[model samples]
Target: MSNHEVRMSEWVDRVLPSPTAALESTVAKLQREGQTVHRLGLGQPDFPTPDRAKQAAIQAIEDNFTGYTDTGGILSLRQAVCDSLRKEMNLSYEPDQIVVSAGGKQALFNAICTLCREGDEVLIPIPYWVSFPEQVKFAGGKPIFVPTLPEQGYKTTPETLAPYVNESTRILILNHPNNPSGAVYSTRELLELAAFCQRNNLWVISDEVYSTFVFTPEKFTSIAAFPGMKERTVVINAVSKSYSMTGWRIGYAAAPQAVAQAMLRLQSHTTSNPSSIAQKAALAAIVGPQNEMEPIHNEYLARRDYFVEAVRGLQGLECLVPDGAFYVWVDASYWCGRKLLGRMIHSSDDLAAALLQEAGVAVMPGTGFGSPTHLRLSFAVSRSELESGIAAMEAILGLK
Candidate 1:
């Protein structure tokens, strides 16, 4: 190859950079340059890691426990995960059925790679987490997009997913408390979808990373809790979101023994084990008291209420009150084909750019989440930051 020419894996070419990360980088650059940019783009929780977890990591370091661990994580950590799952979600699993990885992203990659065969189709709901389709493609699976309606709470039901199923369909990737839309599935909804998966013989890779952020009256329920699902479902979760430990990079998956073993093998050749210190931290977080959890959840709910109201009051922006997670998915289609700041607004990408550059606000464009007509605003920051961001946006777009 010539000096100017580069060669990379085909998989690299198939996947796109994560839009959320890109926006974060841009915001960081602007901040470094002394610009006042209000951040509403990232889904990272603003809370600090729990003190118990922090002390655990410090103790682990003091005790020189920062060595390589079992490929599937320390047995104790795995057992803690099993106990936590049993207590929190009414799910039963053996420690051997769990494969702990570097983070939720890695755990998801492991699941997709292990369960998907070449050319098999994976059902992905639109407005999904940015990584879903790309990971499926990297695993040599086709991503079949299934659209869900906002009126239906932006959730996929059996009816919405039925038309996409065919002979080659192998898996359904379910994200509830969905990332961009914050749509949490009800038990009845999950039951119907579970039955549909049973009928179609499809496996499920349930991304429950945001499971603890539900704002609904009913508690969070995993599809794996349904009948006949544990055998075919891979439940992925992490300490990153719930425990405010994103930087620690600890995540895991619970699946059937065969699937867990396959994923463990895949992880063995990749990241052998997650950070030993982080594992210790996660252990403490999992087994320690959770008195602070209720307050954190309530705070997020309050922020969601305020942000959703503020967003809906903006011109050319409409949104539903999300049931879970900390994002408001705003339909900005009304701004498309209109002009803003003397520039023609064609899609959410343009709107997002204009907002960032002209209004000093950072928001994620929906193009990466499979919608060009939407924008995702996160309320996971401080209330002051959220208010500032909303005010900056209102200054530019005007209030309804």
Candidate 2:
């Protein structure tokens, strides 16, 4: 290797490019070969941004709002965030405590950097979002994974988390309406967990980006809104899922003033500020015709219902009905450590590879989400895609 062919820093090298994004490239290549692909690899929404939000961005450009704004985001957008929190969650947060970031991804990273240090252990639930552990590792912190099985509705409980808690434990990353596993904790569940965090003096980073996708009769509850939790909790959310504005790059975190300041300090040098136009769009999203969410929510609910029924009917594949979010997590443990169709299947990754190559269906492997022998099929794709993907997966597994 030449001197210029140097290695990336340990931190950067430790993280894999987002698994979903990596698979997108493969899907593109396969499609270019004139092959059909059913994409469930990424959790990105397929809906367009609300017209009101798009119009706001267009107006911002016309109004010459292209220049960089404050590093913490424009005051109006932050205030909108605060107002939304009050209206929806009945929680109060000063705009000063909010830092609008490029996406929920960046918001979470900022919070992690602010609270975690070398040797600090952050408790993360199994079947978590792919980025949580990697972000903690990048920040020089250790991640202690707490298992949450399907029987528990794939949620972290005080009892399940207790054993992982030790003197070194400093934070807990909770993503309700969880990414792959669409587990939504009940208020009672959160109350108990909040008590546990209080007992341990631990900080909580609550990823509520999918808060609006909930389909359960049990209401979505934020841990940050509970008694005695606001000071120690960082609530992370975005307009990506709710408003179908993934490309807008607007997510925010509401935290204690000190922690918010630390995040702002770090972000000021890094991203400087989220896009000014995006902020205007976000402000419009927050205050726009929220009725647009009804149709989007209904579509996700319909898709979720259809996908769950289809998956459970397939032989050797078991699915848990997700209460929220657009992902349907299925147990693929039947294929683990087994041989099928001339391939040695040992892990979720191997199975996912086989399916992608053999079936032309792209699904995310559970290994990326801290689970083995499992797969996460995103229902965010079109119904036709879902029908085709399910049939392909069912046939590959020898199901009628």
Candidate 3:
């Protein structure tokens, strides 16, 4: 009750710190102290932003295009979004249906806040992006975690999601080419899920930030592209992952007209339009020639292969070859209840801490992704870093 004391909002207690960002900060602090830390925990790509985008941004700066823009984003950039979606996903959208925000996170927050009401239940698949459940809780909705099997490629089917549905269920957040797990749903799976959602009268928030990284024979298909799904779907994508413009911070959402406007209204009160220069850069990236894409994708595919093999070679660790995205979801349950380095390995947090302290390697523990006995490793780093990380880990755990 003291005047100098300020009470924290109940919202502050609902969410945990972002595990990935926390790990990044720890690694950064170590690096600053001149330590050799192998970074396998972060989700950012190592590639540089494309030249066309960079040049466009520089030009915008030179032209003094630095003022605040329309809250929903400039018409040109929104139009570019529509064009990109139409060409890439075969989904038609108008500029008015798109809302550009600071990043995919903000766009997702806007959608979750605008659609999710108090007491609504949102179905979130396990091994989800770390922010999904937290965002739902912040929006006054309860997050219903739907666990998916590793054998099933860490994907949710109607069978897996059915038991969690009820009248309070309002939305299903689908992250394809999913973060951490790298599971990409096929067209058939999308159709089945689409039917399931329609039958349940559920809205879907499709997060497609990694849509460009599919390595499987089947191309990526958004649930929004399925019959009767677009009307109730909010599709989110960002140049951050696709074009390696993470620092530029431009992401967008495509929804029905009403939903899009609602998101825009929310965005207006928050971080209005993203940086104007970044909007220009994103427009250039979207409308420019995409010749550099295939090579970057192929590189990620090669890294995925090498990293998966290296991980499986380590004793007490197993992982499935990912179909898309740049992460390997590793099962480290073998180490739980065991001893490593004369310490108890009770969960992935323990394993991760041991690896970081004793082995100089940093990998994401899976507790934040809803499984404490697993780990998430990123292949998004350089091939040399991946090899060094594997070697560092092998030094601690030994080869299988």
Candidate 4:
């Protein structure tokens, strides 16, 4: 073998560096050198994990439950997941149909690897989570982005996706309570899309990680609830957002028997199983009392109200009142071609850089999510921090 230079996988070459990480690293580097940075670039919650879940992990360690668990995950955790699905989502699943993964990210990855093949197309709506398109490419499938504009709430309608569907369209990834845009699909909206998928014989990969964070009066409905969707929907959920267990890395996927088995086989060759202690902690989160979640939900609701109101009042920017998730997707197209700090800004990337460098505030650029004229501002931090960050941005944008 020649040692000079080696050819890499085509998929690896096509995948770009995560925009979230790139922006965060740049801000972190600046802050490390004694610069103060207000981070709104990443979607991490600032709250602490509930004491009950943390104690469960400590107990698991004390009991020496650190051995290898079932590749599908611990039986108790899987059963808890089933119960959660039944109670919350009104969907029934057996333990055999669920597979615990390192995070919701991995659960989606496993599903893609198990289902998609070379030359297959996965329909993704923009603005979408940064990882979805890259994961699809890594799985050797084509990511066909369905562009959703700010006027349409940054959500793809069933009609919009119809043009992209064909025999090669293997999957359609739906992130209700979306990442960049916190647009939650209503029941009527989901029914229309479900019908389209059913007609086209496409699989539905539902990323419901933000299911619990809905703020509007519109009730949360799972696409799997639709008739015939159960057979094709792979529901990906996690303890990360709802339980404040992001660092714990506990997530799971529920699907039909065949898809579950395929994901299990692929996981066995890859990650094998999720962390045992984290799974035990997640079991506690699911089976333990419900009172802990209420408080967190209430707090997030308050933050959402405050941040939305603030963004709505900002001049020259269009802010969508998100129905779910802890993000505000702001249309900053007004800033394009404008002078900031004596430099002309042309894109979302430039706007984000200017905010971080000149305003000492960090935000994710919309180009990463397939919308080049928008920006995502996370309000998961404390109210005081959010206030300061907004003030700084206002000063930079000349918005009072």
| Worst window of 10 by summed lDDT in candidate 1 | 1-10
Give the alpha carbon lDDT tens digit for every residue of 53-107 in model 4. 8899999999999999999899999999999999989999999999999999899
In candidate 3, residue 27 scores what lDDT? Answer: 96
Clashing pairs in 3: none
| Candidate 2 regions with alpha-carbon error over 4 angstroms | 1-7
Can you list the residue pairs that collide in candidate 1?
none
Model 1: per-residue Cα lDDT over 49-91, one tens digit each: 9999999999999999989999999999999999999998999
Better of 2 and 4 by lDDT: 2
- Give candidate 4's error at residue 162 in angstroms: 1.3
The C-alpha lDDT values of all candidates are: 0.94, 0.91, 0.94, 0.89
How far off is residue 339 in model 1, in Å? 0.5
lDDT for model 1: 0.94
Q: Which model is ahead, 1 or 4, in terms of lDDT?
A: 1
Ranked by TM-score from best down, the candidates are: 1, 3, 2, 4
What's the lDDT for residue 371 in model 4?
82
Cα deviation of 168, candidate 1, in Å: 0.4
Stretches of model 1 off by over 4 angstroms after superposition: 1-4
Q: Candidate 2: lDDT over CA atoms?
A: 0.91
lDDT tens digits by residue: candidate 2, 210-263: 999899898788999888999999999999988888989999999999999999
The TM-score of candidate 3 is 0.98
- How big is the RMSD of model 1? 1.1
| Candidate 4 RMSD computed on C-alpha atoms after optimal superposition onto the true structure | 2.0
